[model samples]
Target: MSVKIAVLGAGSWGTVLADLLANNGHEVRLWGNSAETAAEINDHHTNKHYLPDFKVSPKVVATLDLKSTLAGVQAILFVIPTAAMRIVAKQVAPILAETGAKPIIISATKGLEQNTHKRISQIIGDEFPAELAEGLVIFSGPSHAEDVATHDITSLTVASQNIGDAEWVQAIFMNDYFRLYTNDDMVGVELGGALKNVIAIGAGILHGLGYGDNTKAALITRGLAEISRLGIEMGANPLTFMGLSGIGDLIVTSTSVHSRNWRCGNALGQGQKLDDVLANMGQVVEGVGTAKAAHELAQQHHVEMPISESIYRVLYENANVQDEINKLMQRRGRREMDFQR
Candidate 1:
């Protein structure tokens, strides 16, 4: 059964997913924001911006027109960065509502909206009415676009308030090259996706500072404890953090060199300015925004996420990173702490 699918965004993940689906015999259209990128994908079948070496499948067509991107599509997979989601959603909502397509809308971006503190799904729902917001899904987990392009063993979770709709997403995504799972914990899955980037940055800072495995281990472990604590307070299932999107993503991102947040932190640890690192990468480091948001969330909920708080101060308040580290390490506190809290 061939499904008509359109992926909005020609970045690494979008290109990789377009390839996976096209190779699996689906009609896949890739939409790019830039005319040059759209041309590269349509004419050359390559994404010079993200994945330059790999050639995309012929079944994958690229378009610059938003209306063309949504034409005859059964599902819309949004792969744009979190910062650009609102602009993209505004463009799609009218098309989706007027055309009566009501296609399954899935957001692949990870990170909360800084100003509104809303999740991607929440942003979409707020932009579109309930009738337009139906069939919403979030695709996230430990999967990285670079590794997935190389046919690595990448598994991820598809979550939605609607289980039946999420199952549709699982069916469309699962193939021999990639495995998929269905989850109902939308909050846990989403927070894990958005929050791990901040922890990964901290991990990179530790690595750049000549820290050993023991130190990295502690950061990863304790970092997860903090995320779990806040996530539980925010109505997320505590056990979800122990699953694929939680500890699994944190371990992979903090340990690997592929994470953009980790790379940004590595530069920061090497004493590079935030602007310099971001200018060089030419990509959004979601942790930069999420760090502050999570830090604010912690303050609002009276949850102590020291790691996040420290990063927030270092990034926003211009606090000394070394001093922040010391504050966490030598905190005057009691023992026998519950990992849950």
Candidate 2:
């Protein structure tokens, strides 16, 4: 069955996903804030600013009109940044309320709200009514836009409180190159996706500081432990952290050059100012914001996340990266398998 879908956000991930859905024979209306991006996608089937050297699917219609984009769509996928998630959801709420549309809401953006420390799904739930938000699905994993653009084999987790909704999303997104698994642990899935970005920044710092494979390996492993600790405290399943959205996401984001968070940390590690690095990236470095949220969450939950705390300080408090690293090394050592503090 063909589904009509509205994909919000016009960045690299959004464009690639819209093209993928169109290729899967769905009617996809891609909405972006930029008129230039919309015109380029509609007229030339290209988004040079975001995904240079790639052509968008001509079948996908790109538009700047949000109301038109949501008209009669059965599903809406949000790929925007976390900072914009609430505002966009608020805008969509009134439009959906006017049309009496209860579309399946899906979020691919992975980051917590900075001050509130709320997940993407939580933010969406706050804006939309219960009927529309009840079956909210989260799409997340180790997949990157650059890899997905080239049809690289990738697997992701689609999580929803309602299992049926998750399976439906899995069916629409799964293809030969793109595979999705359904999970019921929305909390674990969302946290795994969002928190991994913070750890990836730490990984990038290690690389930028000329650390070798052994150090990165240690960082990734220990990073997962801390992430899992906070996640478990926040009502997430312990096992979910071992799956695709957890360890898998951390590994890829930490190592991949395509990761904006890793690249941002690399620049910071190499003595570049945070502002300069963000300005040069031309993309949202989710980890920079996520680090702060994670740090706060850790403090609130009384969870020991030294690595995330150090990264947060380095990013926000003008702390020296090397000095933070030294602090981490000097911290009291404990059992490797101890998750409970």
Candidate 3:
């Protein structure tokens, strides 16, 4: 069945996903805050700022009116940045209530709330109706918007507490080139997606510092370990870290040039100021904010996330990136196979 969906956020990922859904025969309405952006997408079928030289599906419509986007929609996908998620959700809740629409809420955005350190689903649950919040589905994995826009072989996980909801999402998104697997571990999936960006930034820093494959490999591996440690402490299944949202996400984000977080970290590693790097990138480097959340979460959970801590210091404290790296290297070493405990 063809489902009518609303994709919030006009960023690269949102545009790509809305286009994909349109191409899949679903009626998709992409909502953007900027009228100019909506006009460009509607008139030209191109989000030039985000996806230059890439054409969007003509079947997709862009809208500035949020209520219209929600009308008769079967599902809503939130791809906005974490910082803006609450504001958007607050604006959306009353509109949904007024319109009497109860679509399946899906969060593709990754990152914990700044001070509360709540996951994206928690943020949504805080603002939306109870039923929608309880059944919220998360879509995450190693797929990049740029690659997925080109119909590249991309696979992701759609996780929900409700298997029926996950299967519904999987069915809507699955195609020859785009594939999705269902997992019940929402905590693991969300953390895997959100936390990997921090590691990817570290990977970028290593790349920018002229480190080779061996260093990258070590960072990726150790990054997964710390992420898993914190994730496990938060009640997520340890094994979920080995799956698509976990190791799969960590590997791709930390290694790929398509990663904005990696690029942001690379710029920082090359000695660019955080503000300067973000201004030049023209996109939200999620890891920068996520690093702060990770730092706080580690402290809250009494978990030691050395790499994440270093990255956090570099991003937030104006600490010398090289000095932080040196500190990480000089840290006391321990057993590598201690996760099973």
lDDT of each: 0.87, 0.93, 0.91
Judging by TM-score, tell me the better candidate of 1 and 2: 2
- Which tens-of-lDDT digit does each residue in 1-341 have in candidate 3? 89999999999999999998998999999999889889999899999999997899889999988988889999999999999999999999998898788899999998888889999988988999898888899999998899998889988999999999999999999999998999999899999999999999999999999999999999999999999999999999888899999999999899889999999988888888889888989888888888999999999998989999998988888888889888988877778988632
Candidate 3: clashing pairs of residues: none
Whichever of 2 and 3 has more lDDT, that candidate is 2
| Residue pairs whose backbone atoms clash in candidate 1 | none
How do these models rank on lDDT, best leading? Answer: 2, 3, 1
RMSD, one per candidate, in order:
1.3, 0.8, 1.2
lDDT of 1 by residue, 1-341 (tens): 78999899888989999999888778998998788887877788888678767888877988888898898899899999999999989998888778778788888899999877888888988888786465689898888888888889988888888889899888877887688788889889989989999999999998888888999999998899899988999999988898888998898888888899999988888899888899998778999999988988888888988888888887888788899999998876645257544
Candidate 2 C-alpha lDDT tens digits along 127-158: 99988788999999998998999999999999
lDDT over C-alpha atoms for residue 129 of model 1: 74
What lDDT does model 2 reach?
0.93
Off by over 4 Å in 2: none
Which candidate's TM-score is highest?
Answer: 2
